[model samples]
Structure formats: structure tokens, C-alpha cells
Target: MDASSDRELPSTQEDLEIRAVSAERLTFFGDAVVAIALTLLALELPVPEGSTNSEMWHSATSHRDSYLAFMISFVVIAAHWRAHHRVFRHVTATNSRLTSFTMYWLLTLVITPFATDVIGGHGAFQFRFVFYAVVQSAACLLFLLMVREIPRDGLARPGTAPEIFSRSIHRAGMVALGFLISIPVSLVTRWAYVCWIVVPLVDSVIDARKGRTARQSSQD
Candidate 1:
């Protein structure tokens, strides 16, 4: 009895399997949600209607705003999914917080199509534009939270380098900042769209410089 009382138990193989399964399920679910959001965006696309070639071209041109909104949303969702794929690959465990954050992130993704429709609609230009920007920014910020949570909560696989997620966090933050800055700019003029285009270029340059600096520091 005394010997039995002194024995300690180790984690069972089944427990480890469950953890891996949970993480995989979460990732698969996220991917599915993202796919649906993208499909929705396509479904809502404005169909160019006309009786002749010239008419069809004019119709398409008339709905240019709708087409532009669709393009922007499609890119945004694709980028978010790519980043999600990158971070979730390192995740080997799941927790309540991760699940909650992911669900909220997906919510933003789902709302993107609706926001695109609103942005392309007539009237209330600033309000509609800001609404779309806010949605995109929320998606970016939520993803940043997920990236940080993965490593902070020890969800990543053992021996994984912390640096693996550092770049992702930085990218997410920069994208979010771009969207946020555009909000105020939207109030004054439509030139705010330039932020979305310019910020990534700037981030790329910064990232390259940082990489060089890191390399030099390591050499030193």
C-alpha cells in the first residue's frame, strides 16, 4: 500500500492524442469558416447585365465600386487566412481562450462580405468606408492576439522557436495600424485607400532592414 501510494503517473498517450486532435480540429474549423466567408464574397459580386457588348461593358463600369470592394475583400480574407495558416501550424494544443479568440476572428471574416456591400452602396460615403475599414482592422488585431496567445500560452510544439511568430505579430500590428489610420483619413477624402496600399510596402522595407540588422548583430 505504501509503495503504491508513492507511485506517480505520467501523461497518457491518449491525452496527448486528444490535445493534437483538438488543435487540428480548431485549425480545420477556422479554414472552413474562412472558405465560407470568401465564397460569400464571390456570391455577392455584382453581376454585369446587358443586351450587347457595349452595354455589358458599361454596366460593368457602372458597378466599378462593387468590383473594387470585392477585390479588396477577397485580398483581405486571403491574407488573413494565410496568416492564420502560418500561426496554427505551430499550434499543438488548444484552450478556451484560443477558441474564443478564433471564433471572434471568424466573425469578422464573415461580416466582411456584408461590409463590402455597404461600402459599395450609395450615400454615406465616409460612414460606409469607415465601416469596412473597421472590419478589416478588427480581423487583423484579432489575428495578432491569436499569434501572441499561441506562444504565450505554450500552445506551440515543444522546441519551437519563439522567433517563428515574431514576424507574424509585427505584420498583423502594421496592417491593423494601417487600417486604423485610414479611418480618420476616410473622413476627409477617399485617398485613405492609399494607406492600405502604402503601409505594406513600408512594412516590407522595414522588415528587410530589421533582418539585416539582426544578421549583423548575430555576426558581431
Candidate 2:
């Protein structure tokens, strides 16, 4: 047989297998990057260097902003990781577009540590607040894009529930909106972080009501 005749066209199943491998690798790399980012955030905490107990106490207290920043960023990173896991769980295959979105999202995750450090070292500055908010908001938006892209890109598994996808995207959008709003709010008041908590609280109440309605409908 001629060389041309001997060549086999790539099968759909083969393509899917390659995509699945790529997606798994991407997720593994994403997990590693997130782990590193969290470590970098923790490292931002200053060592309480002092010879006396009183001096040590003063040093530790002085770094209160760093500690607060570390806690907040840690929680934020953890939330993002959880959301990422949920979204990717439904994804059976990936395309270049989805991969691109994942890369951008990971980029934001990597940048988060620097932003956290800025806020930790200079939390009082409006610029720092806005910068950190922007970084986190970008991460949220990218993840939201990925969540939406999965179904749109035809990467979602056939058995995946549409409601779960919708809820994931909605939650991500809400979180991103909160961060975006906090940017402008930060300019006006130093209490802008309150905006972040407000959105989630409102979402929780709405989700609870939805759950109740669903239960009542099932009972009926």
C-alpha cells in the first residue's frame, strides 16, 4: 500500500482521549499553582523578631494587617479552588478555548499572592485595596467564563445537571460583582471589604429559599 493509503485518519474517540489527558494535566498544574500561591501568601507573614516578650508582643501586634490579609486571601484562594473543582468535575472534554480560559484563570491565581502581599504591607492605601480587588475579580471572572464555556464549548458531560452549571456560574458572577463593586466603594470608604461579605450572605438566603421551594414542590 502507498504511504497515503496506510495513514489512518484521527478518530473522534482518539481526539477525545487527547483532550481528556490535556484537561487532566491542566487541572493538576492548576492545583500545583494554587498550592504555591497559598504558600506565597502565608510567607508574607512577618516573623516577630524581638528579644523580650513585650517587644515580641508588640511586633506581632504590629503585623496584624499581615495576619488579616493572610487569612482573607487564604479563604478566597480556598473558595476559588473549591469552585474550580466543582466546575471541572462536570467537564469531560476540553477545547483550546476552554484551555485558554483556564490558563488566564491560573494566571490570576498566581498573581493573587503579590496582590495579597501588597495589601498586607499597605492595606491602608486605596490603591492597594483596588489592586487586590481587581486581581481577585479577574480571577472570578475568568473562572466564571470557564464555567460558562464548559457547556457552551460542549465540554460538559452528558449526564451533568444544567442547574448545577447555572448555579456555579451565578455564584461566580455574584462574587466577581462584589469585588468589582468594592473597587469603587473602596475609594469612598475604608470599609469596602464589607461588600464582599454582603453578596455571599444575600446569595445564601436566596439559595435557602430556593431549596425550600424545591422541597415544597416535591411534597406537592
* Highest TM-score scorer: 1
Which pairs of residues clash in candidate 1, taking residues 3 or more apart in a chain or in different chains? none
List, residue by residue over 104-147, the lDDT tens digit for candidate 1: 99999999999999998889999998999999999999999888
Off by over 4 Å in 1: 1-11, 216-220
Q: After superposition, how far is residue 5 of candidate 1 from its true place, in Å?
A: 11
- TM-scores, in order shown? 0.92, 0.91
| TM-score of structure candidate 2 | 0.91
Write down the RMSD of all candidates, one decimal each.
2.3, 3.0
On lDDT, the candidate that comes out on top is 1
lDDT of 2 by residue, 1-220 (tens): 5655546444656778888887788788889989998988877679997999999999999989888888899999999999998878767787888889889999898888888888877536799998999998999998988888888867877878888789988899999989998999988998999999998779889989999999999999
Counted clashes in each candidate structure:
0, 0
